[model samples]
Target: MQLGDISVNFVELVREACHKLNVDPMPVLNEYGVTPETLASPKARISISRFMRIGQALISTANQPALGLFMGQALRISHMGLSGYAAMTSPNLERAIRLWIHYESLSSVNKRGSSRFYLTEESGVAQFYSISPYNEFNYFVVDCLLSGWSALAHWITGQERLLKEVEIEFEAPPYAQHYQQAFNCPVKFGRSRNALIFRKEALLLPSIYANPATHSEIVSICNRELTTLVGATSLTERVKQIITPMLQGREVGLTETAKQLGLSEWTLQRRLKKEGVQFQQVLDETRKQIAETYLKATDLTIGEIAYLLGFSSPAAFHRAFKRWFGVNPKPFKDQHASGRTDENTATGENT
Candidate 1:
């Protein structure tokens, strides 16, 4: 399955790791268009492509190829957003792990039919989906996910060396020795699956933080979000998904989009029409949503945002912004920023 966008929450893990190494992450983050404001939004997502690029750069800068393993050690429940909270309050380790797997999309998205991670409850094994043909670009993804889950399991259940063993799909790399430090358990490579094998009895370990009332409420919220996420498989939604990643530095037209969707141009048009939306409309709407995000959640200049959004020129972007919001970009951004500040202040006072 093709990779999709992941939550900015995961990016924070990288940033925290950089801090531990005394490496400034901003240079790499800015090079990839990740801004402070973007990280501030719990709901914001970074494309998987950009996330990988950031990881590679950070690993190089720190001269630590096993950066993902160390980064996983830094994982905390707070880093997971709502899903973490739900898992923390679960009745036991098994339920907590299941909640994490079930609500995985709250933190990251895989392609429509793909599962990013799974748990074999009966065996107490948790598996991360393989994105093989592993190289410097992607090996860290597997390392971070499996190790991160193990770290969280240990933290919640108050168990040290919680995993019985780790099974990696790929053969050991040059840094194989470091796996011992990351997992503190038997680490086997060239296995059929990438998994963290838990001691069966450990699956019943009670969470130190489990709270029945809180768990119930958070699960309800997660269920609603899951419903909204999975229900968005409409053709228009699919078109937007195809359009988002393609907007990095170039305009994506209907022909390219239909090609990506594996549908002929004419057929794509007919289907979108059947959904009561036009191709250009969907494209513009997608651009508008992304533009709003860049404007509100990044310090990027108008020209920079324009280039990222695939506008022909800054003037073109300004005109489009005016058309979308009925105002020019600068004042509109200021208005929203001020509103956010006020909202934050009010929230603080209430708390």
Candidate 2:
């Protein structure tokens, strides 16, 4: 995989934007080598830099201010390869999101389960929310997701109701104003989260093709991408990024995990594979070793250790630890302390 490929996936949004705006924007995608042919395939995955390039094209062409409008109009079913799958397998807008949450990352390996699209009923209104929290490619993720959220709204209902609001945590700047009309709704910035909101009734709307076999094919394709995602350095970098922060609540994404080292994520993956190890195995093995070291050499609580290893809960940590060492952490800690006492007593007698 190359940056060009990843960029290509994101370019789908730009491509649609150009079409909706009636602007010929081929040169932007062409500059990065994202072709119509490459995009037609749902399983094709690409690189980060190329996606950035495509984003630049939109930023330039749409005028930085109108970027959101360009983006909002760009998101659609045809772009996500969900034309058949979203309609059939999902049963409704809600179920379709469940599939999308699990499978949407497959459209481009760039996201890899770091985003969301849903309708939340709260505060006297049903709200639609879309998010991309786990991505290193924030600009690309936000742009792609905002557009997809907008597109999904149209797909769910023939009405083409725009998003209720789009919120981002980034600094409020010249880039913020353009999104206002794109949503044909409200937009908020410098907020606590990055997400898009809409009405709840949108969940009941369905897309064009609701067929089973085609949906299964889409599932199969996305599954393969998910499997390939494992052991890749991208996975390793994410683990390290998340783990480092959980340990210190410091900037974990800042240090290169051998994945964050490059402008292109695929390059990091290739480099790791050349080194004879996949990111997933390295992450798991590293965590297990670290957990053991923490258990034996430190007095940190089990909860802290679990969080340090990036597990969501202590039970998860214990299970993983047992699987790795064949012993629970409490017993392991006790045994280490006992050994330390024996050695200390022996040293005292010698003295």
Candidate 3:
């Protein structure tokens, strides 16, 4: 339960990338204090700084500045471990993207910055953008993310998609040609944003593993993992996780949550106060998050949704929904069904 900052799974990817170029990765791993065991663990992680150091090492060892593109191309959903399986089993590309956004932190953590996806109906495209602190390996991160998206989409949908365009925040490198060729699209460097623009229709493709029954089961598993991830990292997340499932059939309160966490009510209250949160605040936030998901992803009736969230009545749920979102639940669900989404809002970093 280390809840690693970067998934150790990336070690295999880095190794594969180096092997393809006939470069040995042992030196880099040794230099960075990474080990074969670290890479072998499905749950261990390395800090963000160390991850970047390793990425730099991989690039230098391979003698290729565009190593990220190559590594991403070699990645498959199966390589993502549990996170990958969840995405592969999601109903569609869009749903899979949302699920990944929601559960990403269960596998890795991002320190530099997070990523967001914005849909522009007028442009007929969706833009996946990253907000990261400037660093030497920024391009590598961008390349891997964009190319990874392409690769994952292809794997899930059995369709090849060429990005509409790729934007980089830095100047073009000497190997910019490789990027252009790898993405099979125009790669623009020195742009204000690091993003991959794709046609909206591409997100509508059906996943080969799409099954309503399986999707629900996988999501439940993801929720449990997310709970574990937060429990290891933050008290707030642990409480939220506890509140999520319990909201379905029983009253969730500080007393019950504290008991579940093996702490006294007073101790739990004090801990949350130390974290600058109150029990009520966490409960409300958790409800808002789950409410949005149920409205958008499921066909449950408003009354049923309300009951599922442990609200006594649909009217009670409506009142709370309005307070949280400035709109009623029905309208919110309608907007989501119509293809409108919260643009700047996402559950986790793009990775």
Candidate 4:
């Protein structure tokens, strides 16, 4: 799946980790505009830059170069929400990891790359690797991710996971001793990759929470959420996310959308072009989709719906709706209002 922005809950976890170290997270939270409301809601997102600023603040405040390592050790299964539940309820550690990896994006924004587990039978080792983007938070992101994986495994099986060795891509930090304490294993820095090496046999351990029936049910929910999140990962979906709310208030344009996404208008255009979509095309489609939903489901007037959709006037909305559906709005509403049960008339075009 394509990587994109992260969930605000991960930022909340970072703040929780900071609090564990007796660090006050407010100053940085205020500076970056991450409000209590943002942290309170798991579905909210913090842009990549804002997330890095939080990491920077935690490190600066705690004066711990190995803050990420300490933070990783602080992870709890409950912090991951549905994904955590799905993982723990899996039949075995290996299946649990698969569940975790599939829905991990529900926990964090994964812009650099998605995570994966690799099993090497020859060495009887399973490797967990996180692709780190080339940013200041690269090490911090990977540290928390890998360590959190180890932490989750330990929590699920109620057993200690003595990693074979922990390999890090970055040079050893000044407080490197913390790595050994965090991972409870030898740590190697300046390695070719960042991965946690462990015995493959660990994958066979039965989870105390495992229930095949429950797992199957929760898996369906996870898959649905995965589809939604994956859609939000695309450039077009990102734009629509921004445009949807903006439309309720005022006209949303490319410049404003690009600004919210932290990209120059042209850069956003180029990327969308690569995906074979135009910015206006995305905006119009979004408006049309919402317009149709409002027309069908709500008793709101045509003028009210037009205004809510950011159209300057009902006439303009009429022209656009006709262009999209090849019919006027009044007749469409009248069909539904008159108790006409024909699917074609209710759909506004098929008739």
Candidate 5:
């Protein structure tokens, strides 16, 4: 399955964490082709694989394994963008959480499926879908999400330690103790699901930022944005479809792509800009997604895959693959071949 992309807002959070740690994040950000201008764009996004590489880079630079926890603590409601605004204006925490979940695609896209919320009369369980075959590169993703939700709940209610308990899908790492400190509750590892358990009554608490009229207005705005997002996604998908069959040891430039789409190069650029993406960004993302699928799901040799994806050479493909996933393609393919799913084997560098 093709992985999805995360909003550039997440890159900002990583930058914030870098500042808190007194580590300069520019070198790493630049290495990933992210800039202040890119982050300023509300529609900018990074592929999930690329973001994982960034997280791994930051963790190494800061020498901090628990960076995701720090990031989670730094999360503010406004960081979530429109989905956050909708939640902030909702009349109660329960409705706020539901609204946020419903509109989450506005901020990030996870093709595995969005997080799920199961509400009972006495309790509510907020479950994060597993992005499993866990490794150091990805465990922090779960950490940031589960703890970020806890932090958001506390922020909305003006209360601390709102979770009854936390459950993680993987075994406890060496930094497992930090999970408890982060959540301020019993955290069970090796559980069937990654979830936050909460008191249903607590969910009924009125949001500190709640307003009936403002919520109505924000929900209306979110609806419009969601519609726009869907339309923009269709455009991106069309571009990807055209780019796919063209990559065969040859570069697919924007002009060529525009010709294929029956539009002038300038017109194509304008449309993509309206969708919050550049032509080059779509091309690169398309290559990364296809490269990953080829490495994971086929017996194609590295040179063949590289040729198929239009890389100049196998060595060049090696460099790009490392840049995309923070690992050499050979090891990644080998890991999958051996069915090695242990989180303990994931050291962030090679995983």
Candidate 6:
């Protein structure tokens, strides 16, 4: 149910990956039931299920060089940056996933921090995972995890494909054929976890271009920037992360949130200031998201929604929502409610 943060251009990543595969990825993407257009919107998210189907398919069919080399090429790293370089300096393929997860945002402003790789063991198989925080663009996470790692493994051993199995956590859908193609291995769904399985020998593959110097440098840089990328994990990210969550609730306030995070009022304020945000401003932004989420998704009365947001009065909520989105709650809700349900928005997707 998660992809990296909500901002990454997942469709672009898919397109780039497809480009690397030397086939129009759109056809495959469409086969898995996603349109290139739907994912084009910055705030838009694909349900996790759809994302997995596409990912499974790609991993089954795609070659290793396509996953990294072409994906790197698709992102235009030659002039702008290095997808391969980032993947190369890591200690292992898992570290390489983190590099893509960390520096991914550098290449795409929409890239967020939710996509991550982890390991799991079930039924005696080594499962490497890519997880998402919510349901949006879940396929992107699945695709990247399967294909990206497969690509990295290939790079290490100079092989074509690396995964023994792709263990998907979600239920299998209609795209089994395509799924088989992308992963090029047994694909199972509704499993305990989402992962790629490799034989024990896979881990022993030496990185084709391991470098201690570059590895150290990238790790240092990744550490500093990753803290910021989390945007809600550390003091910096905490402010960003809590902004939307706190706003949606009725009891938002500086002192309350400071207490919740186990910090004194002054300390929280100082930290947020360093991150270029103030308590009141962050509070307003939070309220705006809360206001929008409630307005669009619920039938609660204006008075109730306002009260739920810690607004002293409905009028204040209305005024604030207007400033945040140019239109007030009622109209915003009305417009969204009237629109087709083809695209369901993420309640707390943030930059």
CA RMSD per model (angstroms): 10.9, 17.1, 16.5, 16.9, 11.6, 9.9
Q: Which segments of candidate 5 are over 4 A away from where they belong?
A: 231-291, 294-351
Tens-digit lDDT track for model 6 on 258-315? 8867899999999889878888887666566546655654345677677756677788
Q: Which ranges in model 4 have alpha carbons more than 4 Å from their true place?
A: 1-3, 122-136, 231-351
**How many Å off is the CA of 218 in candidate 3?**
1.6
TM-score against native, each model: 0.67, 0.54, 0.63, 0.63, 0.69, 0.50
1-351, model 4: which lDDT tens digit per residue?
112356666777788888888988878777666778667754666554446557866788888767677667888777777888899899888888777876866765432334667678632233444332223445677778778888988888887864677888777766677777788888888777777776677778889889989989988998898897566568887777677656753688999999988999999999999999999999898888767755653356788778767888889899999998899998877767654221111111111
**Candidate 3 structure quality by residue, lDDT tens digits, 1-351:** 111156766666877888888999988887666677666655666654456557887897788888888888888876676778788888788777666656676666542233556668722232334323244555686777677766776778887653677787777877778886677777788887777776678778789988788778878888888887665668887777566656764568888889988999999999999999999998888778768765764445788678767798899999999998999998888877766322221122221
- C-alpha lDDT (0 to 100) for residue 40 of candidate 3: 64
TM-score for candidate 5, please give it. Answer: 0.69
**Predicted model with the maximum TM-score:** 5
- Over 1-351, each residue of candidate 2 has an lDDT whose tens digit, in order, gives 111123244566667766777777777666555567766654554454345445655666755545544665666566556432554455555566666656544554331224555444541121222222222223544655665666665665555563556676665655555565556666676676666665566566665556567667776766776677554545445444333333322223323554344435566556667767765676676677667655654456788777666677889889998998899999888888655311111111111
Q: After superposition, how far is residue 305 of candidate 3 from its true place, in Å?
A: 46
Candidate 5, residues 1-351, lDDT tens digits: the string is 244667888889988988999999989988777778778875677767667778988999999889988889889887899889889888888887888778877777654346878886668999887665577888888998888888899898898757889999999988887887899999999998899999777888889998889889989999999888677656777788677667777898988889988999999999899989999999888889878775764456788788878889999999989999999999999978665221111011221
**All candidates' lDDT scores?**
0.79, 0.54, 0.70, 0.71, 0.80, 0.54
Residue 156 C-alpha lDDT in model 6: 52
Q: Please state the error at residue 27 of candidate 2 in Å.
A: 3.6
The better candidate by lDDT, 5 or 6, is 5
Q: After superposition, how far is residue 12 of candidate 2 from its true place, in Å?
A: 4.0
Q: How does model 1 fare in lDDT?
A: 0.79
Over the full model, what C-alpha lDDT does candidate 3 score relative to the true structure?
A: 0.70
Clash count for candidate 4 is 1
Better of 4 and 6 by lDDT: 4
